[model samples]
Target: MSINCRTRAQRRNQVPLRIVALRFDFETSPQKIEQQLITFLRELRWKARGFDPADLEAAREADDWSDELLACSPSRHDSDKIRRRAQALADRRLRASGMAHLDKDAREKLRGLSDGVRVVQLPSAHRADEIAATLHDEMPWMAQATTLAWHAMRESVRSGAPALHLPPMLLDGPPGIGKSYWARRLAQLIGTPSEMIDAANEPAGFAVAGSQRGWATAQPGRPVELFLRERVGNPIMVIDEIDKVGDVLSNKGVNFALSNALLPLLEPLSAKAWSCPYFRVTFDMRWISWILTSNNRR
Candidate 1:
């Protein structure tokens, strides 16, 4: 393989003043070689465009075109192209309504949901610490968890990265442990909207993740509905009796399971690109904090 390096000024001027070039033959599979070439060309393009190499590497490793677009594009217009491409791919899979066909009600609902998907920006580390302290004081048993959560929040703030320190927490204990109460209390303390899903009664997973539009009685997912109603992105979602979630066979002859549906929402990467079954649009869902309570450890 051979690579050519050029000065930023030369790159800006579209000058081909190559500094150095090296060549090598690799004894690798054809597919591997093809992937390597593609990666090398992508890095070259990003560098030529004067984008941060680290950002390019991160986007490539994560397979996130949106991040890559943000790194390379200087204007929203350029980034929109990348976003549109991603949406097109998602549309191909789901065959959902396009943005052009979205009615006013659907657009308004989506706008409301988008507001709820964004992270709650904190002012400073001091405020984050204060919130943590208050949470610990209110729920003495969760002191350790609160401390860690605040530390993570402060670190994220300091580093100028999205706050993703707090992962979905599953509180497990016997009955009468105030598990549900604590979840609600935490949400109240954080000053965000909260919703409880009674998994024991609502066994169908579609209630949580939403049913596809083609299905009868289809509607937006619980989280989307909560966001639309509360008009907040970072709501506290508490799933009660999660272990008691029952399986159900859908009208499409597919088995729907709560745990399976919740998996993407619980993970940061997948949640960042979550596609709503109803709206059929992909949106970030990493802002929502999840709390699950189960009587049995399993």
Candidate 2:
């Protein structure tokens, strides 16, 4: 084969992550080539060992498009190039980590449970089923609560239709029933991490003091606001004990100060782009999925 063809073939071999050339003959059987490739990938512990032929073809085509884009435009962040690079890196890392040996059935099980989250609007039945499946290996009542919250969010997402109107979730349930655990586990099943905040402990102070009267006054940090700074766009943020939120425990003299502090997050009108009163900076919470849990239904 020509040097260019040989180089291309070597690159293809390297796509499965082991950085070495194979000892196959020019007349090697196709089946044997496949078997050897699979064995090599398995020995290296590649996570994408079972990638479908179609997916591989798509990836290859994407790489071709990315190359063309690079040749024509030469922008580093070009969408095609970025996506292709991301896929290549993901393939390399998965294989290098040897996640490929895990049971395909287990991966498939997680996929089925998480598939709905990928859709714009998940069906209520599917959402409920997903919640149930996530808690399948856990306690019953807790599972039921998770199912309820999941369905509520699903319904909220559905009602908004072409535009999303669900301002995340605020789950109110009794303590010791796995409220926070449900949020964390649900995030995990969806392949996203959950951020948890105890509403009872966040600092209450101005992000910055202003020149006007009451502007220099102390304010409180709202849990949701802080969570937005940390996990802005994820599918879950667990704000626990919302009832005890704010500085009401202090007799420093104030009424509804905590509610006022949280007003930007709780009020339908002010919450559109909630901000920290201290910093006077607004944050976007529309697309974020929040799961607020309180002992009291309020």
Candidate 3:
């Protein structure tokens, strides 16, 4: 092959992960590849090893998707243990929905998360320094907030966390100074998915803690759904206009301010076992980085 051709082929080899079917090669015969997969699966453990292509019609009639999980999980997470955990959760969701079999929409909705929650590789000191310098240049006015994020990022790395986890940060300053923007940029550098919630729109705080299943508008919290969509365990969440989160009361006379909703999630122990009101499932949300922004320290 020419130099360019060789380089391209090498890159392609690395592009695909070491997952189920990806282990096969063009050079290997089908019989040999099948044997290789069997041996590999024998060692790996879990359901994929037992998936028989010969039973395709039977599996199709039954409407199962376990075999296909092998095809997509390599990009989701690297740990087989985590993959199993995610698989269990996905199975529960499917069973609870009372679906007779799996379909495209179900697969798409739970795609990344059904695979696993990926713990992103922490940033190195050099990378951290680069991000700090960039943030400083872009939003010089939020230096203190920037410093806290920088320190937290470094501490998480030192503490040997699987992913970059920053402590919940409350940034207080005048509006229009790019505090939320800075938080988002930091998430980008750290390679975590992020979401921005305008507290002004969420008086009841259900957007953060999720609502009871009995409620007509019930659904999983942003953090849970974000994890499912992005497959990242440590996603950045920016709560903009936190001071505007009203002290709304329900008919029963209970306050549901966003700040109250955040207490359980902010507490390390409580967050580790947070139960979603909508899904009725416990989730470990401690690793999520929360950045709450406000116009003033009210």
Most accurate candidate by lDDT: 3
Candidate 3 backbone collisions, by pair: none
lDDT of each: 0.63, 0.44, 0.64
lDDT value, candidate 1, whole model: 0.63
Report the C-alpha displacement of residue 266, candidate 2, in angstroms.
2.8
Candidate 3, 1-298: lDDT as tens digits: 0001112111221111111111111222234444444444433443455655455435434536556544523433344444454455555555554331434453345433443556554546666677677888888888897788778777776776666778889988888888888888877766667888888887567888888756687777788778766555767888988888778887999997878888999999998878766555556788788988999766
Candidate 1, after superposition: displacement of residue 167 in Å? 1.1
| Per-residue C-alpha lDDT of model 1 across residues 129-242, encoded as one tens digit per residue | 877878777777766656666786677568765433356887887878677877776555545567888888888887779987766898988887776665555667889989
Tens-digit per-residue lDDT, 1-298, candidate 2: 0001112111221111111111111322334444444444333332244445334435445755455333333234444454465555545544443333333442232222221221123334465466556676675666556566556656654565422223446667778877787777765544333566666674332321111224455442433333323321323546677777655444767543334554454455555566433333343444445566789664
All candidates: CA RMSD (Å): 19.2, 20.7, 14.3
In every candidate, how many clashes are there?
A: 3, 7, 0
Q: What is the number of residue pairs that collide in model 3?
A: 0
Candidate 1 is scored at a TM of 0.59
